[model samples]
Target chain A: MSADVELQKVSVSFGNFYAAKNVSVKIEKGEFFSFLGPSGCGKTTLLRAISGFAEPSDGKILIGGQDMAGIGPNKRPTSLIFQNLALFPLMSVADNIAFSLEVRGTGKVQRRNRADELLELVALSGQGNKKVHELSGGQKQRVAIARALAIEPAVLLLDEPLSALDLKLRQKMRTELREIQKRVGITFIYITHDQGEALTMSDRIAVMNEGELEQVGSGHNVYEAPHTPFVASFVGENNAFYGTVISTNGDMVRVSSQGKDFLAKAGDLKDGKKHTFQKRDKVIMFVRPESIFLKDQINQADNIFSAIFKTIEFEGNLKNIYLSIDGVQDVRCSISNAVETATLSTSESIELKFSSRDAVVLPVGPLAVD
Target chain B: MNYFFNKNGPLISTYLIISIGFWLIFLIIIPQLYMFDLSFRPNIPTLLRGGPDDVYTLVHYKHFLFGSETSGERYNYVDVRVFLDTILTAILITLINLCFCYPIAFYIAKVASAKTARLLIVSLIIPFWINELLRSFALRILFAGEGFINNVLIKMGVIDTGINFIAMDVALYTGLNYAYILLMIFPLYNAIETLDKNQLEAAEDLGSSMIRTHLRIVIPHAKAGIASGCTMVFMLTAGALATPVVLSSPNTFWFTQLIYQWFNMNDNWPRGAAYSVVLLTVSVVFVLLMMKIFKVKIGEIVR
Candidate 1:
């Protein structure tokens, strides 16, 4: 029942401002795809373009290989779950789920049965008769999903639908959403700002920044092999080093920052081009928190630094150690709580090391704002 | 009562309660009770108090129903016609006001930009600052034989001569519609403004057309406001005095005019009280019937 969606250089602009600029990507049928970006980064606008609520100023949108120009939201083979859920407060859950069917002139008994079946699919069985407000927040979320699925759309677009829930419910709903997507076998295009959500559920993720797509890859690829500085910093916490490339060896580049040299992997040479880094080429290096280790815990590493331990932040399963390099830049490193490193006091000098493959070096460009 | 006192403090609460009591008793309840008493009795000379001729009777109500014996008509066609005309015209005016004000309210609340909405609301309120009587007179002049509209029509060669808008009851209809427009609009606006725009979009996104979206989502949500606005406009139009009188023509005979004539011109307070009670009772019942039809609760309407 699912159809692949393709965008050919789609752009949505409001006169002088571009909400979504020249974005082109293909979402495969039955694939769980996510657009991940910060607030106002145009991920929602891209989703709206697919759902036909917004018209792209340039290029074409093809759903199931059919052009979608001049088609309205209702005429399209898509359904949208709004950020607020948008459930009708005046209606019962069954009525809300059956609304699309009712609009198509379906009989009441059949609509009710379909609504019941959808409710069961969302794990909210026998909850069809309750008013919207009578349900808890999680129940309402499930009802919204059932309502969207009732239309049997080729593609379902969700705009931060789980954002209203608490942390525990959000985590639970994430898995449930993934399960429902698998069961329905429909193309699910999810939009969210939270990196954890994008990483956990998406079959593939598109990282967007300022109306442009920074990268499109799997969870592992975007986190471990980011193509741009924005994708590196936005997807996860990273220790950014502003430096210049002093030496290049094959796919590895050695960058020096503040007279301290570090080795990191270079970005892939695009289009089978054998591009080599030149000497004195200014670059930015990113090292993930989990990649950095205490020098004593590692056998040997390509790069090592001496840093002053500032403070320790205890997250239930992991401990985040804040450190400063040469009393200037803030560096963070995460280790398991099982490691008994509590003996180390604050402001103590500590040696840290990371493998060359753990850090990436790319050309200096825009980074994500906190 | 305790909550009120706690919220406002003893002194202010006492003052507010006393003021409300005075207004309800002396201004409203007492007068209405007096009218009720008078409506059940015959109109007689002051010296005939407690006499046989001054006894409580249904004579005034019967006079309202059947004309006076001196007129020699089996049934009171003129007064009855006027009574029915007043009700039907009032209903018509309410419907007309709703038709015109609904879109205006929607535009202000939803479609217009914030700055434009503020400007539109301010513009809607500015005309109402003037007194109703003054506005009605202005409308009369605008719709008169050689008034502004007729003169413009004549100049534009749309008509050979001026249109008699007054005699056709156009002036009265326009005056009353203008007079009670805000009553219909504000309630509708207040209701529509609180509606989530997402619901409208969701309905449309679910393959519902524009008309179906309004019928299922927007109208159901705005039902309270519609009922409130319709009830208010209907009651106000039925009891309206100044607009119908000031903008009156040969054909425009309002029920209030008859009540006024009975009280002032004929000095028959009993018949006037009877007519007043009848109009009030009918209006209240009609409003309740409308509320039932629309399935709107009084609490929702008041809210």
Candidate 2:
């Protein structure tokens, strides 16, 4: 029941604007694949294209080695869970879950049985008689998943299904969704704007922006070795500094920004080629806040810079220290919530250090913010 | 009283609320009560020719079931027959409107582009801005012995002789459907518009055909609007006086015409009042029945 999905130069254009442009990816069978991006980044559009809700202007999409050309959504062996879940409000939970069977003209007894079986799978056993409205939000979410699964689709497409739930519920459902996907043993293509969710659940994550794929890899690889500045800045909190490469040796590059020079790692990303940067090339170097530490914490590091402490933001378990380095880029470093970290809130100035291997630099391109 | 006072941020005083309440009773509610009261009494006009006599009887109500008591002929079931005919015709007009307007409503709300939707709405509403009476008259001319419809059909060789369509039931239904199309379309548009497009997509993704998508999902979601629209259209068509008077053939006698004749021509005010009351009761019953059958609440319908 599982099938690998392949997209080759897929492009979905709406008049003058391309919603998904030249996007290509290979989703393995029974794998949890996620498209992570900001709003209007074409992730949802690409999902729709895969589900056949949207047509590609150019390129091909093949499921199970069959080209999906001129195929409608109903004919595609794929099911899409809408952002709102879109459960039939007037129908009972069982009826909503068994709708695919009903549409295929399955008998009442069989449909009811299938519905009951799916409910049990989703941990909602013996609740088939209740109407959809009677269920809580999380229950409704499970019912939606059951409905999609009842169709026995080869690929289950979820378009930010947990976005409407509260934070705690969303976090809980993330694990539940992953468990369900594993149990079903089908390719699960998820579209979301939440990076934490993608990082937690996805076997492989595709970071998209402006209708194009910026980077695609395992969660750790994407975060630790991003191919582009957009992926580095967009995936997580990163302190970005724009400057020119003063020297290049082997795979290491010395980049200068705001009249200060810092050594940064530039080598072959594990199992992937590194984007080579030449000397005098203007580049935007990105270093994750969590990568930087107090100067005393790591002595004699590959890169070190100091700045005046601006403010500290307390976020329950962690605190972020914002600082300005020589009236240049604003740098932020996050530390665990501790007495020592709390005392730094009153500090006027701070010193920071990070290893060259922890930093990523790409040729000057469109920054995530601007 | 307090509700009204606070309705406009405390400026609506007790006196104002009382005055409006009295105005409603006098102008609307009281008249209905009086009509029901007069329906139970004799038709004898007083010396002053205002209100009914003191005596009350079931004769007027019985007259609706049976024939006129004073008539010499064995059968005078014209009033009951006309009443039934009116109900049947109103239902027909409502069905026609539903069939005609659902596609247009769905198109404007979901499929058409923003500019096209605006243009369609304006086109549908602009014609209804003209008085209903005038619109019927315009149709009357078009359906006359040598009017536009007959002339075009004749030229197209669809028919050799011109048909007198002005006095046909088709003309009446066409007028009723057009007159109340905006009411039906707006409610349907409002309901169907609020339906998240994802639901329709979800239905389609689950192997449902376009027809089944509407039947199982879109239509159920829009039951409230359908109930409200059908209620209004049925009531309006059944109570309409001008369309029947102008469009119906001499052979056709609408219930409203019978009421008109009783009140105006025959001066049988009691009988007219009885007919009015009966019509009002039937309309109310129909509204409740529609809501019940659709399982839509009053709150849902009004919205």
Reported per model, the fraction of native interface contacts reproduced equals 0.88, 0.97
Listed in order, each prediction's TM-score against the native is: 0.95, 0.94
For each candidate in the order shown, give its overall lDDT on alpha carbons.
0.91, 0.88
Provide the lDDT at A21 for model 1. Answer: 92
Model 2, B1-303: lDDT tens digits are: 566567765555866767889989998999988898889877664764445455778888788877777786555577777899899989988988988889999999999999999999999989988988899898778778889999999999999999877556677777777778888999999989988888889999999999999999889888899999999999998999988888777898889998999899999998899989899999999999998999988888778
- Candidate number achieving the greatest DockQ relative to the actual structure: 1
Supply the DockQ value of model 2.
Answer: 0.86
Clashes by residue pair, model 1: none
Every model: iRMSD: 0.5, 0.6
Error of 1 at A57 (Å): 2.1
Against the true structure, whose TM-score is highest?
1
Candidate 1: what's its TM-score on chain B?
0.95
Error of 1 at B31 (Å): 2.1
